[model samples]
Target: MPTITISLVLTFATPPSVGAGGASGTLADKVVARNAHGEFIIPASQVKGKLRHACEQMLRGRVPLCNPPRAEQMCPQIDKDDAGNALPQKDGLPCCVLCQIFGSAGYPSRLRFHDLVVTDADLLPPETLRAMVSLNRRRRVAEAQRLFLIETAPYFNGLQFQNSEAITGQVDQPSHIHIVLAGLQLLFAWGGGTSHGLGWGDVKWEAWLDGQLINKIDSEEVKQICLS
Candidate 1:
């Protein structure tokens, strides 16, 4: 199993909402995911979903990736009649590139994401994890029934992929490595509220096999692959 260690500096363009999986808090209505250390973190599942979507968009030639990569997954291209009545997709099959990596309904995902922990070496106070309040627009005021709180992470963090089989077929390892690297740099977003403007980050990738830094991914390499 080959492993890729990735480093990222995340600057939230807007408030992010990576759901905490429950509404157990006494004060805030919702919370962001955190570790036992009380540090804000993004779970591996979130990372996988974002990357899978990016792969589907770039490889499948769709603007936004499909939900389940199925027939119901909204296609960007629209069909219409002479009268301008929209038509549904006639084919009921999913044949996207994500099926090869993340797997389809019955297949298993080839990549594994390790939880990305925020490396806030500044040792800032735990209270820095800001809690924001939201109110309803219809009421013209903040009401208890419509009020909610969202927690946001700090500025910078580190991310990693513990293990992934970049190449499953019988070919040179370098070819398979490039395929996975391109997916990493496909300009993806993480956590929730991305559509609402949040979690904007870029990755500087480094790979290791048997404890050796073999290669670094550059823009030129990615361009060459896209051209090919």
Candidate 2:
């Protein structure tokens, strides 16, 4: 297996409410996800899902891929026996390239994403609370009793993870690494509330393969391959 290390810095241009899964025990209706250390952190799952979505959108018309979130539509589709036992994938059946890299229910992913954390505690801005209300679509008015407070982390220059804490993964083929890089390049906005202009940010990243810096990735070439 070939090893890949990715270092990413995410800088939010506006206050973001990435949500801590749910309310913060009466503190706010929604809060930013954080690690046990109480420092704000973007979960690895979120990052991976976003990247997968970006890649899926890019490859949709160019290649064969299963529409996800629908088990029946996903690749490497499994079968079941009369006894309700899950059957293994047929030997000759192949999964889509995105599934090959991001994995599906029965397949394991080759790439691993790490939580993006604040690069420096001192650089963190103060957290703020904002009151928001839901709108009634029919009447185009604010709905009563729908007012809530959302906790947001102030905008910052960069939040990153590097060195031993960097994102680490293994690839079955060298070209798969380029696919992952191209996906990362496609990611711009992140987290929740993007439709309302929250969680808007940019990502700057560097990757290394087997301790050797990867200076460039020809995303155009990867697109061409997908088209073929």
Top candidate by lDDT: 2
User: Compared with the true structure, what per-residue lDDT tens digits does model 2 show for residues 109-153?
Assistant: 867788887667687768877787888999999999988777776
Reference-based TM-score of each model: 0.57, 0.82
Q: What global local distance difference test value does model 2 have?
A: 0.72
Give the C-alpha miss distance for residue 120 in model 1, angstroms.
3.0
At residue 36, give the lDDT of candidate 1: 84
Q: Give the worst 10-residue stretch by lDDT in candidate 1.
A: 163-172
What C-alpha root-mean-square deviation, in Å, does candidate 2 show against the real structure? Answer: 5.1
Q: Over 4 Å off in model 1, which ranges?
A: 1-16, 26-29, 62-96, 128-147, 154-176, 195-197, 209-228
lDDT of 1 by residue, 106-162 (tens): 435455566566554364334324444355579766666544444555443432222
How many clashes in candidate 1? Answer: 0
Off by over 4 Å in 2: 78-91, 136-140, 156-165
Highest-scoring model, TM-score: 2
Judged by whole-model lDDT over C-alpha atoms, candidate 1 comes out at 0.48
